[model samples]
Structure formats: C-alpha cells, structure tokens
Target: MTGGPRTEPIDARAVLGRCRDAVAPALRAAVARLDPASREQATYHLGWTELDGRPGAGGGKAVRPALALISAAAAGAPIAAGLPGAVAVELVHNFSLLHDDLMDGDTERRHRRTVWAQWGAAAAILTGDALLALAHEVLLEAGSPDAAEAARLLAATVRELIRGQAEDVAFEQRDDVTVSECLAMAAGKTGSLLATSAAVGSILAGGPAGLTAALHGYGAELGMAFQLVDDLLGIWGDPAVTGKPVLSDLRSRKMSLPVTYAVHHGGAAGRELARWLAAPGPAGEVTDEPQLRRIAALVEDGGGRDWAAAEARRRMALAEKALAGAELPDRPRAELVALGRYLVDREF
Candidate 1:
C-alpha cells in the first residue's frame, strides 16, 4: 500500500492527546477510590504506568473514551455527566489489551514490552481483573439517570467480548475461515464495545429512539472499519510506527482479513496458505522465515491487501453517512465526523 494524501488536515494525535489528559486524572481518581489498598502499594510494576505515577512507556491513542464523549456530545448530552462512562469504557478497553497481549504472547505494545512479557502472565491477568472491577465502580458512581441500563450494557458487553475472544482463538485452530464467519467474529470482537459506548451515551442523554439507533449504527460501522484497517496494517504497515513486524500477521499464521480474502480469491496460492495455517501447532513459532515470507507474497499477489483496504473505506463511508441523519449540534457534528474519519484512516 502506498502512503497517500489524507482526506483532511486533522491531527488525530493532537485530538486524542487532549482527550487523554482530560480523562486520565478522572480515571486515576476513580481507580484509586475503588481500592485504596491497591493504590497504597509501593510498586505494582504495571506495564503502562511507572511507580512514580508518570507514563511508563506509552498508553494508547485512547479512542474508546473519545468515542464515549463524542457520542454523548452528538446526542446533546453533558460532557461532565458522561465523564465516568468515558473513563469506564477506557478502563475496560485497557483491560482487554492487557489480557489480549497475554493471549497473543505479544511482546511489544506501544513500543514497550507488554505487561505479560515484562511482569509475567499472572500479574497481567490480575491487573486486567482489577481494571474490570474498577470500570464497574466508576460507572456506578458516575450515576447517569439510566445508570442501571448502562450497567446492563456494560455486563453484556463484557460477556460478548469474551465470546469474541474465544471465537478468534478458535479460528486460529481451523482452516475454513469463511468471509461471513470472519465478519461475525469482527463484529463481536470490535463492534460490541463501541456499540455499547454509543448506546450508553445516548441512553444517558435521554435521546430519542431514532438518534440512539443511529449512534449504534455509526459505531458498528466504525468498529468494522477500524478492524479491517488494522488487518491491512498487519500485513503492510510501517513497523517503525506500528511497533509490530511488517507482514507479522502472515508470519504468525493469524487469520486476518487479508489471509481470509486470499483464501477466497487467490486459488492455488490461497489453498497453499490455508494448508500452512492448518499445519501450525500455534502461530509465529515456525522455524522457517523464508516460507512465511513466501506466504506473505502469495497474500499480496492475491490482492488481499487491496480488498481489505477497499472494504475498510466502504465501512468508514457508511459510518460517516449514518451521522447525516443523527441529531447533533454543530460542535459535536464537526468533532465526531472528524473522529470517525480518523478512526478509519489513522496510520498508528
């Protein structure tokens, strides 16, 4: 894929950075209030924060909280009222990341060693559990009018997220990854959290049914687009920026969008790729780097990268279009539109 011109002159990093600073203090306060015992510990050795309470290595772009705030604003909701909800979603997202790194045995995230890699899997799992509990406490204290309803969404979202993770792990063990199956997996893996966020924000705002539905639709499309773009980058992204090896998805035998498309589009090459995937005991443990490179060539030649990017762009357009019918004030409309565009089009 070529490095191309951006559609707009928006600095997503700048926007995300501001949002993080705004939310981080609230989030830390909420966490500290939940379990003072944990807060009192001298050094927990958590991956993203230093013992001195400074940013350790790096956190993330903090997109989940941004989505919560943007959706709330779009529905004409108060930003302060939605603050706890935003913080809750961000905490849950990080919890997922902590565990996901363990599941994938991923070493590097945000250009630093993952929690599981640095402190061991037990510590990582415990940290993830602690964050999940803190998320619930924060949401409950935030106390929206529809707090009960939002709590229900939070519970259901967690269940669905776990189910989605299971589906992804299972997919790695099989060779028959259909396009429809892959879409369903992506929906559960990425869609549930974003959809819940939008829905919770609208519910808190007392939005009309139509507005709520539109926000949900917008978030669903955004998540689909986000995952597809991630898959594309898994094969073609700059390693320096992404902090992951180029073509690492292919090398690891992961069932990503490009490989799934190749299986359906590349005939013999696709079949060979599928065979290699089935031959694996686990992904990324193989002794042969040259063979893996050959598989990446097959996926590239099969037009999988192009197909995934096109699909991502299509979903992003749909996300943008969904907002056309949403009830939003001017400030929100501008920011949310920009946010949606950047989600689908971001480099890092």
Candidate 2:
C-alpha cells in the first residue's frame, strides 16, 4: 500500500471511489459514438477488446475526467454541466498520449499496443488529429461562456505544450540545461493542460470568480507535483508496476529533474551523463544504457530523487492551500483532496 491510500486515512478511498464511479459512465458514453470501424480498432488497442475482437480489459484510470467532475462539485456547480467539458479534457488527454507514444518511439501504453505500434505512425498521427478535432467539437457543447473559455484555454495550452515538447527535444542536444529551465519546460508540457482542465471545470460549474481562480492555481501546482512524481517513477519505479523499462528516461536522454540535478552537480558521474546525453545522434532513439545506468546511480547518490520528492511534496502543499482558499463544501472538498492525494501517490 505504499503507493496507495492508507486504510486509516478517514475514508479517502470511499470518497475517491464515489467520484470515480460518477465519472466513468459519462466517459464511456462519450467514446461510444466513434465510427464503429475506427472505434473498434482504437478499443482493440486500448485493451477494451481482444485482438480477435472479444471483450477484454479496462481502459485507463480516467483521471482527467474525474478531476473535472470533482472540481465542478467542489465549486458548487451542477455536475452535469461539467460532463461535456470533462469529455473534452479526456479527448485532449488521449490525443496527447497517442502523439507522445509516437514521439518517444514507445511500443506500448496501459499494457496494450500504442496507437503507433498497432496502426503505424501515420495512422496514429491521423487518429490523434481526429481526437484533437473531436475534443474541440465536444467543447462546443459546454455552453456559451464555458465553450468560449475552454476553447481559449485549449488554444493557449496547446501552444505551451508544443513549446515544452520543443524544449524537451532540444535538451537532448544541449549540456547547458539548468534545473529552472527544466521546470519551465515541465510546466509548459505537463502543467498547462491540467491547469486548463481545472480552470474550465470551474467555469462550467459557474463557480465564483475567486473560486475558479483558486482552482486554476490548485491545478497548476498539482500538475507540477504530478510531473515531478512521474520523473521519479521514470528513473526508480519498479518496471512491472510502472509499465516501462527502468532508467528509460536516462536512456532517452530526457531532461527530467534528476538529469538536471546531475548536470548541475558536476562530477565524474555527472560528466559521464552529460557526455552520453550530448552524444550526437538521430532524434527519438534510445542511446547507451550502461552509461545511462551509471548516471542514474550517480543521480541517486546525489540525492536527486530525494530533492524531487521534496519538491513534489511542496507543490502538493501549495495545491492544498489553494483548495482550502476555494472554500468548497465539506463532502466534495474531502473527495477532491482525496483525489489529489491519490494522484500524487499513484504507482502507475
């Protein structure tokens, strides 16, 4: 239970269970309308159907949609009003996953074939594009003011996302990356969309302006915390639980927090890591592993993981502070806090 909720945490599990239950059906119905042929293929890849087209596994954790609904209730908005917005966020989230798999040359996600692996890169790209379009279309049903705000958020978030991706790719070729720069890149790539989700959810819920502002602040902090945790998991988490190869981030020369720290704290190991990451190579391929593992060890020795965990905890505190300022009702607020805690503690 190390990466799960504590049983003595005052029914946090029960609260999150209720929120998850409420969100899942709406997410399913939203996905049910894709053209049968394409839908079947996507579903197959998602492990919702067998390779032979029989019923199969459950889909992803559905966290983004759940956040939207949970935030809506916390803001005193009708949960129904947030459904379209939730669906929009989910569509956008999945679209990012599809494209990310291709960019990282990953073969699998959620223990199933990635869109690129199952359908080829061109098909995956097209499918992701289609999802992006559908995400926008879904936002149109979010009501006038909500739709307009969500659309604005979507546009700005995409810009930041692309900028972050560019920075991430650029980090591979440069030895000058600082910890601050890496955090900025992380914010643009990972935090922007999450911040938008909370902000849009509040808008849809008809929350007071102050409450909506507080929710956006909460999401930004939580998003930062989430990515920091992800960086830690990428390097040190059990492969079976994380569903990815160990030290995969180092192998790919990605500029995550650990790598940034190692770069700053120059030494034999840091130099070795810098040397490997700066190796001139084709984009989007894993480089040397022996050297990468050595660097990962150095990172651990240098307290990079500890530093990152502390930072994540700090951000979590900030998020909670923002939530408190939002002044949500007790039941819904408790659920939201539980959900946030669960996100921070997730193993996969």
The alpha-carbon lDDT assigned to residue 105 of candidate 1 equals: 83
Total clashes in model 1, counting residue pairs 3 or more apart in sequence or in different chains: 0
Task: Encode model 1's per-residue lDDT on 119-186: one tens digit a residue.
Answer: 68877787788888888878877666677777778888888888888999999777888977888888
Give residue 218's lDDT in candidate 1 (0 to 100). 77
Collision pairs in model 2: none
Tens digits of per-residue lDDT, candidate 2, 110-163, equal 677777887788877877776777777777766657677777777788788888
Show model 1 residue runs off by greater than 4 Å: 1-11, 34-48, 51-57, 280-290
The global C-alpha lDDT for each of the candidates, from Candidate 1 onward, is 0.74, 0.74
Q: Count clashes in each candidate, considering only residues at least 3 apart in sequence or on different chains.
A: 0, 0
lDDT, candidate 2, at 259: 71
Off by over 4 Å in 2: 1-17, 266-269, 279-292, 346-348
Assess candidate 2 and give its lDDT: 0.74
Question: 174 in model 1: Cα distance from truth in Å?
Answer: 0.7
